[model samples]
Target chain A: MQSLTALLGLLNLIFFKPYNAIKMNHLNKISILFFLLLNLFFTACEKDNPTPGEDFGTFDLIFDNRVGDQAVSLVNADATEFPYTNNMGQSFNLTLLGYYISKIELAGPNGEYFADEISTGADAAQVKGFYHVLESDPNSQNIRLDRIPAGKYDQVTFTLGIDAETVQEGATGGVLDPAEGAWLWNWDAGYIAFGIEGRSPASPREADQFNPENGVQIHIGGWKDIAGNANMVNNVKRITLDFPSAVNIESRLSPNAHLEMDLLKVLDGHANNVDFSTTYAVHAPAKGKVFADNLAAAFSVDHVHQ
Target chain B: MHFSNLYSFSNSLFGIGLLALLLSSCTREKGIAPVAVAYEFAAPAEFPDPIYTFKNNPITKEGFLLGKRLFFDPILSADHTISCASCHIQSLAFADVPLHGVSVGVNGLSGTRNAPALANLAFKPEFFWDGGVTHLDFAPLNAIESEFEMGSCIEDVIEKLNAHPQYPSLFRQAFTTEKVTTPYLLYALAQFMNRMISDQSPYDQYLAGTAKLSEPEIRGMDLFQQHCASCHDGILFTDYSYRNNGLDSLAIDPGRARISAFAGDHGKFQVPSLRNVGVTAPYMHDARFRTLEAVLDHYSEGVVASPTLDMSLQRGDQLGIQLTDSEKAAIIAFLHTLTDRDFLNDPLFRRE
Candidate 1:
């Protein structure tokens, strides 16, 4: 949708005719015709379909982030309840844990592929093409994708972080809204696709660093074309999960895909053996790539409740 | 196959081209023009893509004029005694005069850091001495709220503008909004400042092959390239990187370190562009050097060693650029070539 400011400007230009009145007059007529055609087209299409779910079933994309068995909960200024320790032997407290999940494409057993269309809120308030799996918000974690072709699906492939387009252009509303204050890293000029800001006792500066009193923030994002000779890298990552067993989807019904995202893997599961003492804050792109790669490896399809 | 058929085909092709051009031009003409003066933001052929995204806040003639008016008005401050122009004068290339080591604000309140020159800001990735503010739109917020500076709240400024008889109408003409918003206000400011580009220096003319440099100036250019071009690189004259140039062994202020929260970043500051270095006297973040000669002397003999000092400035046991008196004079002559008089005198940017 065009911004209100742009629409007002266009209206002002139309009312206060410039030197090129003939051109403006022609533009006005063209714009009217265009809107008329657009209105008619949508109305006709909606009339023909009537109900979108007649041929297909709705599916839920459930993201459960955890540290081993325990569910991840972001605490506000109280970091003493530290329950997790990595291979580096550092007692870390996670104050914030959230990442963007997008571009989900599900493949059928017989080679039928369906791309999950991202829709926000309820059907009435739905906006398409953008999805964010915010860990703190239960509503955001339970993503409802509508109109998946009714059939058995074997594989599900999706990006772990925000798409390159959203990373660069930035979004105005929904999960990507600047006001949401979760994803964007204004200093780096890109979206923090995978963010985990907290503190740990293993930091060289402070022993009780994770104790809310001394918090260290780690914001990971660098979606550039190339990692310049500088210390950062392109940290945006894509992850794919294939189901162990095929799940059947009946027509006009709802199904849920139970997915698990392990937080312990962010440090120990990947090739980069990160030491909390030296690598606690990974804001730069190159340093952030280690966490990004590990987070991509953390997702797995636990089960599919058909 | 026939001559008549070929003639009709060519005529049709020409007609299509004309129609495409007209349609494109029509789309370009939106609202009242943002500026009365016909200035367009075009990066020099040699420069990199500007950090400011024109897509978000497109420059317009009306927007530029409104920003210009707002910039000069003292209503932005708590007391009606100072504006941006009070510290940044046009004659001094938008930098404070020699009297102020650091610029004085409303009620003769003094600031910590010297007011830097305001030119070629669109090309800069970050703003201020420490590279604290990343976006050009948000840079003014720091100055406006600073206790020693304007000391006025943004919400108060907005309320004042809304009450002003002429400003609300001017804002409506520029950005066709029902009421003024902070983002729109920032967009207007960005439009005005982004066009404050200084690309017409004698050095720039030399690069464009439009003017010739004198013998001493030519020699000075070579010397500058060898010694100074690493940090102050490219046509806009800055790499926009933060570095500790070894100004003081113990920094009076921990510069970039305060923003980044890294011990290694201590004493580091954003490399200031030398575009109008001749007019923007009292060099460096502290404004300790009054003249360009003093600045050159500092580099030659007065650099203090520090833990986070830039490796480029370090030479064996000593710190700072080594230069003879004649070489220093020649380098100063070359620095003078960077003065863009046309930009400094541009009436469009003036308070009037």
Candidate 2:
């Protein structure tokens, strides 16, 4: 309680300069009163409060990968079974598919906002909020955000890939660690935020090992926007989804938002139609801008469970 | 008014005291006395502020030593035959030896570009001829993962480090981590590279007014400033800009274009620092020239024009800089002044 008071005093010193011999007007007095009340309210919420509204609970985000209406299933690299077709009618099978999701935010109709803590550092423990959701890894799909205040949340926002600002923070561990399955482009010094690789009969036989004969690999990753250089494109996409229904989060009740990312929408969206025959290999950022433009229409909140 | 001023002054003093107390308390909790920092990165007064993110990876004695060990250890290679030290030798100002123009990597594979001398790297904004890597921490990754260089993945290197008897403990002591991770590994290497500050050369002494240059050397310095200093500018040398210096009419490598994906950037490569140019030969990205004389000759007579040729090199119809034999010789004399013998033979940088 004393520490809280000291913190409030420090805030007063910073915001108001209370130590200075300045005249306090009516507006200043009212604002100070409002600020103190707000501080007290927040302090009360932080403590072990029995208040119903001030209670905190967990919020889970479950990403479900899909191809149009059907759920996704991983196949072998050289599998002949072509399950999905794009707008171009080019059939393809997924050998690998994954994307990095970070900077999560939950919003409500009311003034309740919960932003997941985002930090980047060399320490694996300190690096948080970034999630690498791969079709191969079942455990990586579900992200649980704790310490969310009890509220009725109806919207969620997240960045599809790591931004240039975060990338410039230098080397980071955990999911961002290149040594530990992180899709890092060492030559360009950035992460391959979104990637899908498979083989299509439409795709031509190439000498490149990464994009082999009839192999379709589209990696959307560019996080730098050099001024006046239109060629250097930043393909990192920010996605916001409205929950089908408002879900309540309380001490007793935890909410889960199920989001489905359709592969068909990304490949055959209104912005760009990706033909596997000609547009099979995309390894650079400028090449991935069209696919990144289709990302906003690709994701939707399927449902919410309280 | 006087009383108020006194009160504010006392308040600030109290704040400083509080901060000092907190700092001391932190050290006390760690149970370690305040020791003189041996590995602190001190930028020379004449050099520009370092572009490296030293805040993320601060130089410590343990960390720098660990980095030095990793640098010298060939365990980072695929077959454990090549290390960072393999290409970057300490004697030749951390550049490859003269014989191996393009240093051989794992399994006798040679890279396309010459291994440039490693000095004042902390001041450099980017690495390599392509200038793709933005941070010093990410520079080693290319060498480690490149097909011709270390020919090993970072995952394998980390695994090798974890399994090693000394590496894990050394990493723990350096970074205070339980396990060997990529960031910590990169941090250690960065610590060592950041300490390679070449600021004690004769030219540096000339700048500091402690040493005098010979008549030819002084004339060479004047000529260098008139002709070369535009591209290779300032104290650290090299303006850190990518340019096509008329190296080839048709760029086989497609140098900077490989990274920028622009036709205009084709045949462009980073203008390397001339800090230790005398010892670090053969010169240029492809290691085309064998001697300083040959390099100057290329500048004077052998310049091949291209679309993306540097504007400074193209004087109307003329392709390269005009220089006489005496002028070239004078510039060579001045270039020799940049070779810092103290840095080349520094005991701290030498592998134990």
Candidate 3:
């Protein structure tokens, strides 16, 4: 009985120690916090598609815009050789390089705006600024979209140049932000529906100098209304394409030279009929219409992504 | 006999231990001081939600400070002379001042394009007037790498930052890493530009019921709504779409068409936002019109018909809408209301 009393007393002392109780409480709190931290670490978005870095996948767009060679303008032919015999007796150099294509739309063979939930794509918005194609694209810096939904499409429609609404939105949208050297309508003022600048001294202004001033910047736009006119049907031109069948359009589509703009011929009818009385002048209305219409009609189905 | 003495010592020990633990936790309870996050936008309710969502990069005091440092750092340039602020001045509402219409670059070389104001940029979908850059984070590379601008590559900017002692720590604190990158560099600059929301103008006040529009202003608004609103829609004053407004429908630049490489895309360009048109004179793509009167004349008697001309313009009866002289004055008065004076005087945007 004496031994039993001793054991019971020892047990009471061990169980009732305040230091042990405090230690146990501290340990429990630590474990809970550890678990919470572990959960957070695991749940954090730590996955990288490849390298965890600042860049997402890039959209490398290679405009086979070279296919534009099919279009032959009298002043600027679709091919490389000069296509003009002006009053100066010298053939104007014809470099068939094109301009900015702000937006694009696709239409089915039936003349309907291509729309489908299965295969989707955001409006292919360009990263604003002037871009050029070298003799060869090194990193395959062709046209790369953020990503489009996978599906079969009948046709693709797109805008060859800037649209009217975008013209007034300023540097926020469209292809005319000062950052993007695409719109240089500073010649007479206002926005240039089409801008063509190159080295040609035979024309007005110095050829070879990259001058925001004093250079020949042939901006051929302003399609909404001619300042004082109504229903001008400005630069909004339409081109329809019909696909052979449901074509897989999971990749970027570039219709080479099939989409052509002869930079030289843009002003073929301008110098003679341009009215420079005011601070702002423009190409003859009828001639501007013909150029825009013919250019719009040039874009058709080059091929289908099957 | 010693029980009282033992109790006194043990009680004292427990009391001191408890106080220490409690005090340590209380010291940390202030929670990082919730650093001040003042946007100082002075924005208006009428404007659309800002495009700078602060996604991935949250708006913190450290972030703003880091961005401000980058803005003034010459390290962004090739030779390290020009920062973004060199061309984009504060007094001119972030626009390049002087008569050249172009911004000066490294070696005093001037750029080919006009230096537009970076005001109200958070509302824009694209950056330049041509609408080439869709995302704000990447816009700097263009000017930085432009032969005439800063003339540096994105990789070069990163290299320069590594050499600076203050910048490394600043970047680490703001981005949570010791590493610097293009997106980080751009993200910081974009944050500064995005926060440049200059909407507090007389027009904003009139729209918000705090002020009233004058009769001329009201008349101008009506005329603008009928004639100009089709293209310059919404409070931002632009529909954010590309157009060929019949400026010169030649085959020249083919504005937006070059990006797409399609024929129908020819002769198209982006419309500009008209928020501070009065202060940002030399209007249009080329800074052509010296005054609002010139632009009004272009609309009243300057329109030339082309196939691509917007159909809405055709509805004005005659070839174009012939505005009376009174109507022109009213429109100009309304456009003047868009100027935001407070933005021009903000000290935060100024070089400290």
Candidate 4:
């Protein structure tokens, strides 16, 4: 916004001043030209203005993916190691699992809600609340929540997928930047709200005379819904998880929320247990809503440390 | 002569000479003095707010110039033989010149759709013939990574840019970051393309009550209002909605269906802005029409029937509007009035 003002001010100097000065006295014209040049010099120097830092508390949100009691591992080089099995009796191995978490809200002691500011700028400078959680890297698992007021918070809530405004804003920088990977579904013009990719022998393609080890690529994404159409609901799922107990937070103390994601629940928690033989790959919103629902239901706050 | 008159004469000459110096300064490659002036992106009275996230990436002279350089530079391609300007030339209203049915890429491969014009793009909510890319900032990624186009990924382009002796510093000046991230690159390119506003046409003047259109052009305008206005509506000349437009019974490209993944969206393509329709040809998603005459002919009698065809185009069984030769001629004249010669020759937009 500051730059916009500078731009307008500069424009007024060039266009508005020149138009009026062209008809004015000679001395005035010469003085105005010098003044214009002087303004330009100052504007150039202002380009390097240092971004002021804000004083705020930070909170860490940690995500850990698991199956039953054992931690989920990436597929090995031999490709024969399958450690987890779903309720449908299909053994599978995960190659990738990632999703976006945004619009986080923390309920304070007196029922006051402390919300983290959503960075809308397309630059790394605007990064704050948004984070990408991937199972492959433990370092990437920790999402730093900034600008929280120093206070005691009880319940924590966050959306499983990106909000409508951020989706509509399109590709931004930092975690939301599309250049980081193929998370942004180019065709749909929306982010893959939840992604789970792996290989399963029980996949329908394996039985259909294709590769015996057919891959399971599940990308849940969609953001538009026609008013009358129930089937066309773009699967933009929002999940708000309450901690098993209230978390105590303070300015001096660094608090961490350790959350656990049970893959078993994603496949077998509901009555509609996913069978890899028939349902492995899902791209549409209506088809993805089932998985989105399952995935949203899978996360629980394991513990909170203050 | 009075003393004041002599001073005024000399002062006027000095002003002309100073203006020449300033313009020459703008054309310099580097070491040009930083001027406080910047290009303004004021939306015309008739136009809506720009779709670009200006609050995030503010417009600056250095930023716009960096974007312009990238737009014209072939370094963004794998072989360094093709730049964005290869397909979007300024003289042709930023559409591919010497029109090809589909744009050819690095290795002589061809794209699936015709290269659309890059005029008044800041107003568009979505982009591409299929409306696949939602933001103007994300649009370049499609072309950069396409095997049929630049044949270079963002990673490679970033490496090349960082390695370049000049680009790293230029990136720093445009965006305050030392390392060129994907967002800064996109933001810079967008800054250049978003400023490509083409609104000073004779039609715009007519709206502004500053210019008068000829009788034939007026008649063509009337015909346009009656027939083409529904789809090609608004001052930007597009509603930005995807429609079948009865282009094909069985679409070869699958158009909007590729994005929506629905059979109902098959054969649909985004309605392109006709701001510079006269110069930007051959037209359509496949470059099917070489001239405005051919485009008019398509609407008059060439619309094909399909299940996904826009209902508005269906008038009984026979598709398309009925137009005589005179009507076609007048419409063509009216389209010509939509051209703005000033934009074509704008020195600010030109490469240094």
Strongest candidate by lDDT: 2
**Model 1: how far is B4 from its true place, Å?**
52
Q: What would the per-residue lDDT of candidate 2 be over residues B187-249, giving only the tens digit for each residue?
A: 999999999989988999999999999999999999999999999999977988889999889
Write model 1 residue lDDT over A200-234, tens digit each, in one string.
Answer: 77765443533344455566676654222132356
- For candidate 1 chain B, which ten residues in a row score worst on lDDT? B1-10
Q: Any runs in candidate 4 off by more than 4 Å, and if so which?
A: A1-60, A76-78, A144-154, A202-213, A224-233, A251-256, A267-287, A304-306, B1-38
Docking category of candidate 2 = acceptable
Best by DockQ: 2
* Model 3 residue B136 lDDT score: 62
lDDT of 2 by residue, A36-74 (tens): 897777766665543656689899999999988788999
TM-score of chain A of each: 0.72, 0.82, 0.46, 0.74
Candidate numbers sorted by lDDT from highest down: 2, 4, 1, 3
After superposition, candidate 2 runs with Cα above 4 Å error: A1-54, A206-213, A226-231, B1-37
The candidate 4 chain B region of ten consecutive residues with least summed lDDT is B1-10
Candidate 3's chain A scores what TM-score? 0.46
Q: How would the candidate models be sorted by DockQ, starting from the highest?
A: 2, 4, 1, 3
Reference contacts preserved by each model: 0.03, 0.85, 0.00, 0.41
Question: Against the true two-chain complex, what DockQ does each candidate achieve?
Answer: 0.05, 0.49, 0.02, 0.22
Docking class of 3: incorrect
- Stretches of candidate 3 off by over 4 Å are A1-306, B1-37, B40-44, B305-307, B315-320
